[model samples]
Target chain A: MPNEAVQYLLTSQRDDGGWGPYPTLPSRTESTALAALALRLAADVEVGARASATSGARWLTETQLDSGAWALGDGVPGPNWSTTLATLALTHFEGEDGAAAAGGAWVLGARGQGPNLWSRALGLFLRPSDTVELDPDLKGWPWVQGTASWVEPTSYALLSLKRLRLVGPAADTRAHIDEAERMLLDRQCDDGGWNYGNSRVFGDVLTSYPDTTSLALLALADRRGEPAVTAALEALPGLAADNDSTLAMGLVAVALATLGGDPEPIRARLRNQLSTWDGGDIRGLAWAAIGLLDGSDPLGLLDG
Target chain B: MVSRRRFLQAGAGAVAATSMACRGRPDPWTPEAAKKPANSPVAILGAPDYDETRLVEVVRQGLGICGISARNLRVVLKPNLVEFDPQGVINTHPTLVAAAIEAFRLEGAREVVVAEGSGHRRDSQYLLTASGLQEQLDDMGAHYVDLNHDRVRRTVLKSSFTDLGELYLPETVLDADLFVSMPKLKTHHWAGATLSMKNLFGIVPGAVYGWPKNPLHWAGIDGSIIDINAALSGRRFNIIDGIVGMEGNGPIQGVAKQVGVLVFGEDPVAVDATGARLMSIDPWKLRYLEATDAFLGNVGEDRIEARGESLSSFRANFDVVTAFEETKVEPSTGGAGGPARIDK
Candidate 1:
């Protein structure tokens, strides 16, 4: 099944050596990075996987902006959150090249803006019930600059920074990692899973979504022994079942597999679904492959 | 009527006085729009429920009354596919969307694309499937574009509603000859009412704006609404699904209230004003519509000509959250009520 998924990715790769979110759309940074990572992981057993991964890596490297971030691949301007994913992909394929380090530097420099004085004052003036209950001053990664922090991009940044740390010690990486970790922990929902941004909004305790919760848990895999992480992991099967999305199920399987929890049931479900999958969504296929592959921590999400 | 430039200057003056503390306000660039007489017409047609056959007839009739023609034009239907709700109140009903697709195609549209960038969720496939739109699209063989990841072109904001000078909006929307906003008529906790104009927020690419569109949230919801509508003025039309609406705490998390009507118009402001009126909300109380009334379109009852059914026939008071209590319209006494000029 993993081989078939890899074949789909290889067939779907554009002439520019990247993959798109869907087969018909132009290649994007996030989809390309995920596909490249999955391909590299399968390079050992799958034929032609290593060369395809290199081509994808080459596209990523060549398209790297002067600021060290990759613009969103479809001509949208960036230095956006996709930089984190590109960094992780580059680090995995090329082992800490200039492209990876520059991505780290850009990520470190890119922080979600803290609340302005006016907003902060407004927050102070408003009742707690009227506002989201999280520290706006604690900066995490935003999808783009000059906006508030969100969960998924922040998780990707933490993962990228962790991988970059192994190349050599950058003085600022640890602090960024620590702050991002705090940010993720701070935004965890009441139900033990994670939301896209805040756990609460305007007094409502928002529920968690499977994809976001899985990504956050994967990024926090090293802290698996903690109560919060363990509780979140324990809640995975339910979340996966409830969501039952290709991306959600794939991510949950990867998260569970990375944390030493049995992902067999979820994997079984994904395998069943993938049997009739159209291979249209490259990102979902890549994640499915990474989750269904016979290995723990195939993308080194846990190793970092 | 104030021009968009004059409105901007006044707003800039307000900003200056407040030491850069004011939110983005209206623009003053379109003199043509300002000079145009406020004869905006909105059609309110009754639709009892989600029967696609009946909805198609009602929608086609509404389109006819509104003088809309789809001859060889590329149409993009931007619906409120915000999130999944089991009770089916959060999003525009898929049956209504299917009806619109059929209506436009019957009107000779060359292409009709259903597009949405969901605010809360990033995975649009899950949203499409959960919202029952995937099956609908497949059955109809219609095209669906996830505007979140669509190719974008950087567009300058026509009005300064947000600090974001320009936004990377999806080309699918920008390229459409007739860009229709198909939104569920619902009460928004922040905006007081979510209708056609508010639904334009989904056109902003998530690739650029992020999930939930926090950038617009930061910029001021009312101002961003005005800005987005102003930028895409001439190409826009709206058909709101008011047959079933969410009344409390929505855009998401609200109780379903069946309003039994479909709203249609070319002027988004007028359409929304009619929508608010049907919901028993005073459009004048909504800041976005008020600001928009200045240059965008008519919000006054006397200024707009109602087509099809009378406003009183479908009017019902929708429940709103605590913050928007003042927005509810007081029930009329024995008076000269209803749209000033009702068309047969």
Candidate 2:
């Protein structure tokens, strides 16, 4: 990571020890998690980086709900998708196992709502065009409890589960991971990448987005040999290049590096892009750090 | 005999009221008050295309006709910037947004900010760049707020159309003195038509509610629209972009349909009703507008005073999906006879 970008993330921590998407915004779980992860990645060489990560981790633990989930913050709903992000950040710290495990448990129990019997009947008899071609009963993570599953949240949840070492030896956690993996595979667009959720909507095939596609690829890194994963890997560079977004490009670099693809070209493009980048988007900056900096996979997705 | 559409709509309303009662929250307005709403003026002005100079004058004229007050008020313009479509059918055109900002400034507004919590895209920077809104805002020296990441305040719903009792809305929306909803006049596969009222869904923070605001969809799209609009009842205005709209499957993935008119009104229900009418749709048949008619604004034609260009002059047929065929008002059958479908 560039010294200036590292310094910016370090100095921008709020009094509550969290980071917002940008300065002047209230701190949020997702933003703070991204910042903390970036700082943890920088800890090896940058001074004060470890301390900042610890403080951000402390805020995350402090704000965790009694039900073992983290919300976006005040006024936002609880036990939502950010719990995965918070849990992932907590895994980096020592003595934070209890909080992180509790989060993992909550995530394990959380399930996205699918078609009920009544709705299934309606779809079969009346509303055929409204239904997408996916297993209605296949459960995955949702942005909120009782809502439909989406690609980004499900991918993040899988990444969090993997980081917590919950997936192994064909246990219950492994079963859940397998189900979510299937869900992600089912949601992949015909273009070989994933959309926000549905691959096809109302008979029209939805196109893939670089950001969601990258996250999905990162979550499914272990299955890189699978046809879907291979196809998406082949499509990532072009999509990222076309998007011209720091967030998308950075995520693409991270996914490629983690999946053992040739990330050097995308990283080179990302370097040029970040040099002239002037936006104050913290996620974009944090992603640039995670992708550009020398590091083992920060979230431990590659760890056994 | 009541049609199947009316029966379903009535059933939905009853369920909402029953749920509200079960939750111990009395509705602020009675159904009788909803039925006898005072007449509101909706102005429809003709504009051929997105010529910035011509749109500025037309917007000013429409604002005047709708009786907008902008002196020293902090205005927030929430235009539909949902996704990028090369045909330019998916979002409200940037020229219209720039025109609205200029017209508001000419009307003596203190400040105008363009805000939208994009329902589909998480990356606001990408959406802005892809839609050309960033360039427009930069050129006009306007501020833009990504409401998804903005500070929020929990607000209790004034009306209970959904079981979601309250929503954490962005402070930028709630604090604005004049909150203007600039929606692309288009057909939604689920909602029949997404107008100024339906556009209010963007104000609900995705940071809180998540992308696409699925809770709103799950609670029911029509009811959520009523709930959000009711929450912000008094401090709202509408400017429907019908100059070049969308038809068939929309809110996204639809073809462009040009109507050559802009619809404006203080009452969102009336403005949306006029917008629906311009697309040859029956507003009375739409569930949200029907419920909104009971209290929020006038969807009834007799209760809306037409201003500027006549409604019939700019009437254009908008093709809808197979499901929404009933939503269209047939040229020969132009009365209160169209059927409405409830999206589950």
lDDT of every model, 2 decimals: 0.81, 0.81
* Candidate 2 lDDT by residue in tens digits, A153-175: 89988888887884232225888
Runs of candidate 1 with Cα error greater than 4 angstroms are A117-126, B1-27, B30-37, B333-344
Candidate that would win on DockQ: 2
In model 2, the clashing pairs are B34-B294
> What is the DockQ score of candidate 1, to 2 decimals?
0.45
What are the DockQ scores of the candidates, in order?
A: 0.45, 0.51
| RMSD list, candidates in order | 4.0, 3.5
